[model samples]
Target: MASLIDNNSNVCSMEEEIEAEAAVLKQIQNRLAEKMEVGKTAPPTEEEQKEIDARSIFIGNVEFGATVEELEDHFKGCGEIVRTTIPKDKLTKKQKNYAFIEFESSDSVENAMVMNGSTFRERQIVVTSKRTNKPGMGAQRGRGGIRGGIRGRRGGQQTVVVKYVYVNGAAPRGRGGFRGGRGRFNPY
Candidate 1:
């Protein structure tokens, strides 16, 4: 009889432990469901939603001193201005010579493209699709380890060479083995 009572007690303890575990599991599931419902039902604010829904247009080659207000004023002729932003330098806190202008509709962006190649602040402006690349992504990180290694092995174009030939086209001679030697006002 004592053995039978011990067996019954053990069974009851085991059953109680299982019931406690089940209760804990049920609570966890309830909390997860509540969190999911909150995430699904609570929508973003109007301003945030508008930012997400609005189209993005790139305004490149802007002046370094251009202000957000100035950008808005200039592009206002295109259409109903949604927002104008000029990315600032991380350390210097100055404009980075580029901007983004979002308009109320696609037509506004289309109209703004006409302003491309026009001079703003004495610098020619470039308008196109907003760069989709994430900020702070550098060439070192952009190329994976293997590709980066291969690129490192194959030396890339020298900055001075590229600037002289492609960009400025007036290569300073003598030092870089460029022909015609150094001239004061060399055009070609």
Candidate 2:
């Protein structure tokens, strides 16, 4: 009789715990919905507008085999495509899984934005405005950095010295010559 009572209490406690978890989950869902509503009602700021240009759209999750022609065809209804740029791997020369599409007008950007989360080549693609970096902005170049090329301090300004190294038709020759004294240092 006592064992039966204990089992009933355990079941009741389990049901109460489940109800409590469900209530918490419902609260979280409500908060998320409210936040989403707030975002939808708020207008984008001027700085954000400048950062995300009106005519450029970023397409993400592009398939490896997807071509520029296919992308143009898919977005034909949006508007006239001015240009499309798909960055490739420097060494492999393969598509980088994302592309930037520039439209003829800002209306095209708005049209494309409506197609966010749309299907493309069996995958849902993310479409968003392309963020543009202003001139003289972004990461500060380090001294002697290869990207900005060996910058030197001059008067209160930094001057970059660009050097180009060229190798002629013949193989490069070192201090020991082309073949490089192979048998000179022998280990027995």
Candidate 3:
């Protein structure tokens, strides 16, 4: 009967030990979660991402020496900042002269946009709404397509380019270098 009492005491002590260890583990986990949130960025949920996007501003011509703290201080008057992202060159780890600042409210975004062309760290920064790279959107294709030459292929000369595409005879590919094939044959 004494041995049975001792066994019950041992089991109770073991249960208490397990509960103590679990409590310690839970505390550790909570501390680690706080550290992770402070030091590392976690991927935002879809709605959170959209909220961020809508409340963000694109800042162009940002000085290379600018830091997150400086940016937050500068825009603090606008509203509470959720994040500020300055893209860096992966190879050199240097700022790429641009940044994205996300605020906690649309009013903050408006206030930031009002600072467009304001001088920041000796550069005239362009502040605008954050733009996404959707097709048929953002900056247009820029002057665009097919280099013809210094003078370019004249409108009337397009036929010459079309005619030589399927020439069957011994055309011999004149002007074969950078000047390209087939000198304009006047054949008058």
Candidate 4:
């Protein structure tokens, strides 16, 4: 008799088990639907987006050989220099021709822009408010590349230089592998 009772208690029929689970799931779904009625959290306000958009001053046309120290020295007199960055080439590890400089205040940044467009060194400095470097940057150049090599339809060349390129990856047929110099990866 004890064995019979134990066996009956141990086994719940599949239909009953499924019904129990379905009921619990229904409750959870209802709760989730009710919560969703509160609506998605409103998107961030314009002011918040502006704060996100507001970036540090970006300095371009930097002399390629210029170091971080030289950049600081050149711009320090303009205002409190917060940070300076000179990006290096990916493979060569040498300085790229551009840099980014952050000032302590926006006012100082504005002043620096006014004081520094086409300012002479070896070449004229192209100083302006820092903007995202994107494909459109060349369009702003008015001709073609940075120097506006191509002429636009308006008789005067559009300074904007838009360069479009496409690359195809075709694996080499011979024993020469994709990565010859880099050896196998070993993590200790």
The candidate maximizing TM-score is 3
How does residue 20 of candidate 3 score in lDDT? Answer: 100
The alpha-carbon lDDT assigned to residue 58 of candidate 2 equals 94
Which tens-of-lDDT digit does each residue in 1-188 have in candidate 2? Answer: 99999999999999999999999999999999999898575655777556437689999999989999999988999999988888999999998999989888888998999989999999899999888766676665554333433334433334445344547755334432222233243333
- Over 1-188, each residue of candidate 4 has an lDDT whose tens digit, in order, gives 99997777667566679899999999999999999978777765766534422435666778787788877777776788777888898999988878877777777777677656655457667676775444444544433333424433444333443443434754334332232313344342
Quality of model 4 by C-alpha lDDT: 0.65
Candidate 4 Cα outliers beyond 4 Å, as residue runs: 1-55, 118-121, 132-188
TM-score of 3: 0.53
- Worst-scoring 10-residue span by lDDT in model 1: 142-151
lDDT (10s digit) by residue, model 1, range 26-116: 9999999999888575666766555543455788889888888878887788888877888888998887978988777877877888888
Candidate 1 — which pairs collide? none
My TM-score estimates for the predictions, one after another, are 0.47, 0.45, 0.53, 0.42
What local distance difference test score does each model get? 0.71, 0.78, 0.77, 0.65
Q: Scored by Cα lDDT, where does model 3 land?
A: 0.77
For lDDT, candidate 1 versus 3, the one ahead is 3
Give candidate 2 regions above 4 Å deviation: 1-52, 135-188
Clashes of each: 0, 0, 0, 13
Q: What residue pairs clash in candidate 3, if any at all?
A: none
Root-mean-square deviation per candidate: 13.3, 20.2, 11.0, 14.4
